[model samples]
Target: MTRLLVVDDSALMRRLLGELFTHAGGFEIAFARDGLDALRQLHEFQPDVVTLDVHMPKLDGLRCLDRIMVERPCPVVMVSAMTAEGAEATLEALSLGAVDFIAKPGGAISLKMDLFGPTLVEKVQAAARARLPKARRLAERLRLHRAEPRPRLRPPPMRPAPAAPVGLPDLPPLPALPGEIEGAVVVGCSTGGPPALDALLAPLPADFPWPILVAQHMPASFTGPLARRLDKLCALTVREVTHPVPLAPGHVYIARGEADLIVGRRPAGLMALPAPAQAEHRWHPSTDRLVTSAMEPVGARRLVGILMTGMGNDGAAAMTVLRQAGGRTIAEAEETAVVWGMPGELVRNGGAEFVVPLDGIAACLLDLVPAR
Candidate 1:
């Protein structure tokens, strides 16, 4: 059985989570009433995964998560409230190595929490399978998080079109395309996406002249908080895009986790057209639809489409579309991706022009955009 430790301060929430996962079967559940209790349980139970609540008496989720990463190093999923503070804590937890998040409505635990049983189960299972960071890599990533203003650049490259890492597949060589590099950038990612987003986004400078749009698989409650978190770290401005706001250069617009962020031109300027979620998309805030929508709206100008770490081929085909339209394309290299599905499929299907490591993607992106 996959051993799981569900940690929250509320007894009712603990019971609700326990009942749901127990009924869901497949899991051997253990519970903790608060952060201090959760740490004790972590040592005794040594669960394969942990579902952590953001706030708690005595220890709190952030401190507990830090210790777990240092001592045990298992996948931890954060259970957070939909409010801004909860969102901020959740983002911090992800940076600290938590695999994913579950956003609950804030204020007292209620029966309403049970509605997320299926999602909770699904995420926990994913967490169990996710790769945990080693002590050294974890240190390195955190060091970068605290690094100087200049974005970290990848070490010098040997093979321009490099050989794949030992265990990963040998990708086909991409044929070179047009040399001119003036255009917007669109990114689509999911699954083990947050850390990868940080790897790529945090390094770019504030005056990164082109407009960028990202459609990350997330919920309505989480996107704004994520944008706020990233904006604080990134040199470039980040905003949680809502409604028909006009798009501008040098800023980033993160699509609502639940709504698709579409792009088009208006008499005034380029604009964001976030539409209602469509049932057919499977993943809310579909990256494919967003890219396809932009093809018409952005006109003849070329664009850069990036397919990062994710579970499915959500952005693969659309990335191909962007590449065909005189745009450049990149995928997170197999070695660095937590789940290689999206970027892997993109490379196999010949959609990616560059397959760079996670830390290297920011450099590649800046390379594609010339100073205005």
Candidate 2:
């Protein structure tokens, strides 16, 4: 049985989550009232997974998570509200090392449990199986556990990439304006996507030759904050695709949450547009639809399909088609993935041309796309 620790400030929430997971079966459930209580039980219960609330009286969720990651790194799935504050906190939690999160529904939570319960249980189960990496440096670990933490969810300042190692080629600086669109890179990720995106995009130069389009599974309130956070961290310009935007070589377009991002041809040039999620697509900002639409406008050879850490097989079929049609495809290797469901499926389907770890994806892209 999977061991689960449900941490919340409210007694009602604790009881509801306990009942919900209990009904889901195959779970040994435990509860904690606040962050302090959660930390104590962390040792006693030794849970395989933890469902953490964002707000608590004595110690908030973020601080508790910091300690958990440094002391005993277990898979943690945050229980967040749907508000903007909740979105910001949850994103920080993901960055700090929590595997995934679920939005906490307001109102009589029990009444909404029929709809919400299944998703919560699903995330917890997935978190239980997630891989936690032990490769963090001692200093970085100390920073996270430091007594005086930085302001909550503060975005990292933008910084340029370090000099390339000897014998390695450095990325060419951004070319002069009026550079025509050559091709586009379409990326898809879900679970564990935020930090993975940081690792993938942070290493690229501000003047990367091709535009990057990202479809990360998230809600309407969360995507905007996520885009802003990423923009602050990376040298590249990143923004949500709220309207039809002309594709630019150096910018990164993030698909609006709860909608599908598709590519089409306009009189001016290739455009990334937001549209309602089609009934056929199982997930919003569907990666399959994104890749297929790009193929029509840009042609497969000009396109690159990058499938990263996520759950289920959302992009596997379309990326397979992309590879067969001469498009380059990259899958995040199983060794570094939190849950190898999405990228692993692509590999099994014979879609990916290169299987790389999380950190090497940027370099791999540089090698594939020419600066000239």
Candidate 3:
């Protein structure tokens, strides 16, 4: 049976969570009033998973998380309020070593209780079953102690070679078609995509002409936070998209967990499409489904496909179909990618016509989009 430890300062929250987990069964449950109490319980209960609250009395969640990582090392799911400060703290907790987090519902004790009751149980169950790798655990521990200071080292001296301006082979310019390209921009990314995405979207002018659809492999709970975080950093509007919303240009849509993002045409206009049933893919927000379904309404002429860094060839097959349909394709160059697997496959298989580093992707995209 799974063993769980629920830690929170609020007595009501503890009671509600305890009741929820108890009803969900197949496990043992322990309750702690605060982070310190939780740490005390850890010594006795040795829980399989821990549900931690960020703003607890005595010891804060991040400190508790540090102790747990160094001492017992159980999977921890942070419970945080939905406020911006709470979100920031929760992310810090994740960076500190917590596996994941669930935002507490509005301020009401009862509503919050009802909201988190089910999700809390589910996260605990999932956490209990997860087997963290030793290397990952060690890395997390090191990350906690290390101050992420910027590198100060200068580049090594190099022999002077060329005197002339360096000129790379220019990629074939995008064609000027008879009609306007009329559909969404679908992007598939994983692994090293976070920083890459920021770099790519930062340079996009405010009036970018198409709705951007993205399938980024991430946990469900992290998607919303990730979207919000990206929204702050990006020039375009970014949000976690739901099913049945129409596609609109100048906005960016990020696929939510377990949701397949598609594009469809309705009587009114073009809109975002979501599949009702869950599909099989190694990653949630599967790039294969996103890229393939995006081709439906947009067809070849209206699509722009980009495959970014990832471990598998999920988007390669879909990119081929898009390529055959005359959709534009861009793949990240191997040198700039964190894991070259996904984009590498596209390059090797002749799916991508253009290959560029992460830094230049935004400029390349701007060049592709026709002037409005």
Candidate 4:
């Protein structure tokens, strides 16, 4: 059983979280009433995972997160309210080495908290698999951890698999541009996606010529901050999609968490965010819808599908469809993936034209479809 530490100032929250893990199965729960208590429990309980509340007495989540990452780096899942401040702190926590976060539903915590059970368990299990390295020096850890957590996601330096399985896409030679719009790349990722995206996208030059679309599993509050964070690190312009806007080359469109971000064929190609889906889709920013929607307007010949690390097979089949239609597609190799579920599924179904590690994904993308 995985040992878990539940830290929150509210006794009810503490008990509720404990029960959540209990119902999820395969976890040993330890409780901490506050951040100070959490620090004490850290040594005594030695949990494999932690679910820390953002607001706590004595030692708040931010300070405690800093200490935990610099002192003894481990996987942490922050539990926070679904508010602006909570979202900001949660994103900061992720940069500080917390593996993921959970948003509290509005109002009082009731049986609604139980609705979070499965997601909590999945994130905890993922964290256990992808523990951060012992951060080494405090200053070094802080500097590296904040700037780019994705590089840490890379396994200890090893020879990248020979370039055979990764190269120019197998599609037929392309025709001239349609005049109205240039080609585009649609990306799907979850779990440890932000860091992976950072690693994959930051290296591209500012003049990168293709429009990029990212459909990562996240909530409304989290996605905007993530885009802003990546924009600071990347040369390419990154913006969150709130209203429908035509995608421009050399820019990045991050899918809104509240809706399924899809491309539509207007007089010129365009971007549209429909109503948020409550059923028929497991994730809010559904990659399945994104890829399928691009088939006609974007065309398989001019599109690139990239399925990265995530829990489910959300984009696998649609990625295969792109391949069948003569478009290029790639998956993050298992060795570099945090969970390998999405990418693994893509490889299993033979959906990917290339299976590249985290470090090589950008190169592979460049090779598959040269920038316009």
- What's the TM-score of every candidate structure? 0.85, 0.89, 0.57, 0.87
The top-ranked prediction according to lDDT is 2
**Candidate 1: which stretches are off by over 4 Å?**
106-114, 134-152, 156-182, 299-301
Query: What are the per-residue Cα lDDT tens digits for candidate 2 across 134-164?
Result: 4457764454335222222212232212211
Candidate 4 lDDT, 1-372, residue by residue in tens:
999999899888888877778887899999998888888888899988888999987999988888777555668889988988898788777656677788888877766765777778888888888735233356634544565422223232322223323344446435436344567899999887887787778777676667889998888888898888788767788998888788876688899886788888677556654446557878868888898988888788889889988888889888888877778788888877867889888888777777887777887766655544
Model 3 earns a TM-score of 0.57
Ranking by TM-score: 2, 4, 1, 3
Alpha-carbon runs more than 4 Å astray in model 2: 135-178
Number of clashes found in candidate 4: 0
Report residue 84 deviation for candidate 3 (angstroms). Answer: 9.6
lDDT of 1: 0.77
Point out the worst 10-residue segment of candidate 1 by lDDT: 158-167
Q: Model 4's lDDT to the true fold?
A: 0.77
Q: Give per-model CA RMSD.
A: 4.9, 6.9, 10.1, 4.0
Clashing pairs in 4: none
lDDT of model 3 at position 184: 59
